[model samples]
Target: MKEIPKKNGFTTPPGYFEGLSERVLNKLEEKDTSALPSKEGFKIPEGYFDGLEEKIQDKTLQRETKVFTLKPFRPFLYAAAAIAVLVVLIIGLEKNNTSTPTFDDLAQAEITQYIESRDLELSSYELAEVLPVSELEIGDFMESSVDQDEILDYLEDSIDDLDELNIETHEEYQ
Candidate 1:
């Protein structure tokens, strides 16, 4: 298939560029020089500038003689500043007084729910950092529920794993 050649689709007004400079010069020549006034046509009083310095000094003295006073809203500005300080103090104290939630503070149901939610992504060491176990704190764990015999039995069973870890660590150091 043969493609048609496309035109630019633009056109100029007749005589737009022709004799533009001559037309502009003729317009300039048409203005009359004599009819237009050259002077600014302003006149000053004879002694006006003579006491200008004294007049300015007199105005300055008038202003200086008046006493300066506070604006009507100045007290309100002080009140707002005081209120802002009070609000900051209140917020600061509230944050300071709030206690950190310990294991003892959490309910069994909430603790179970939190555990079941699978939200904790921590390793055992990281979880230990979060929940440090003191003797008293450990007593509170499992609702003070597990028997002493069961605890001893579990510890005895885990002692083998602990011994293996110690031997591995000793070999690594040597």
Candidate 2:
């Protein structure tokens, strides 16, 4: 297939550009001579500029603003800011300290639940090692319902030989 040649689609009058610059100049001259005023309408009053600087200075001096200096109170402001920061720090520290839970604050059931969930195998001797043994008294043990007979029965059933019990005397313990 043959490709057709492309042509511009725009057109103008035969003499449009013949005297374009002259026509524009003539129009500009007509507008300048007839449409626009010869001089601007603004007019200055007589002697207005003579004392203008003095009038401006008088007005400025009459409207003089009060100047404040922070130099006098700067130290007081710094001290107040420091005190505020210290108060906030002390209050924050107090709140944080109170937020921590203590051992005595824990419920017995909660402790038991935690131990059972972890499946800990802590023995009585291991528990005793952590206990405050110095606070215990003979009367504390005597408060138990178990009598001597029951204790002897338990020992007799559990032990096979007397030598197996490495019982210590008070003097030996001392």
Candidate 3:
């Protein structure tokens, strides 16, 4: 084939066309040669290649993939640890507590001593039958009764018969 000179923007050298045909025959190949100047040799007019085009490209709305990573459940772990520690501390405190004497213990001794010391006065009548421990309740029962003298008299007369009566020793006689 006769070689033809290239013209206009779609032009290539006759040898370059021949090379392209050869490349087609061999396999598909890209045409790297352009009718325009190479990028390295390209020079723009003053202020021609400003950042405006880049700014426009950036402003163009487009979908972007965003990845979000959630933080670990460390706070919950700390809270659970605190709760467990609190529970353990509460249990330890409970276990370490010693048995303390209640009001019942204190009142029991006082009541027993009072009764034994004045058994002769108290046993005369069936005072225990009328006023039992279950009826007396847990507090000061004698503090509210209106017949204190009658109660004392009954106790004295009842216990006077007993040989253990030490009423004379309790008197302040000279």
TM of each candidate vs. truth: 0.24, 0.28, 0.22
Model 2: per-residue Cα lDDT over 85-145, one tens digit each: 9999999998889777888799757876887798668998986897568976766656477
Local distance difference test, each candidate: 0.75, 0.78, 0.66
lDDT order, best first, reads: 2, 1, 3
lDDT of 3 by residue, 24-134 (tens): 856533544465465667666887678879878888968597978789667889999999999999999988886777755677568677778875565635666744557
Model 3 earns a TM-score of 0.22
Whole-structure CA lDDT of model 1:
0.75
RMSD of each: 16.2, 16.2, 27.8
Summed backbone clashes in each candidate are 0, 0, 4
lDDT of 1 by residue, 14-113 (tens): 9898999999889778978677688878989899999899989887785645678866667888899999999999999999989877978888689768
Q: Among these predicted structures, which one has the highest TM-score?
A: 2
Q: After superposition, how far is residue 74 of candidate 1 from its true place, in Å?
A: 20
Error of model 1, residue 124, in angstroms: 34
In candidate 3, what residue range of length 10 has the lowest lDDT sum? 165-174
Better structure of 2 and 3 per lDDT:
2
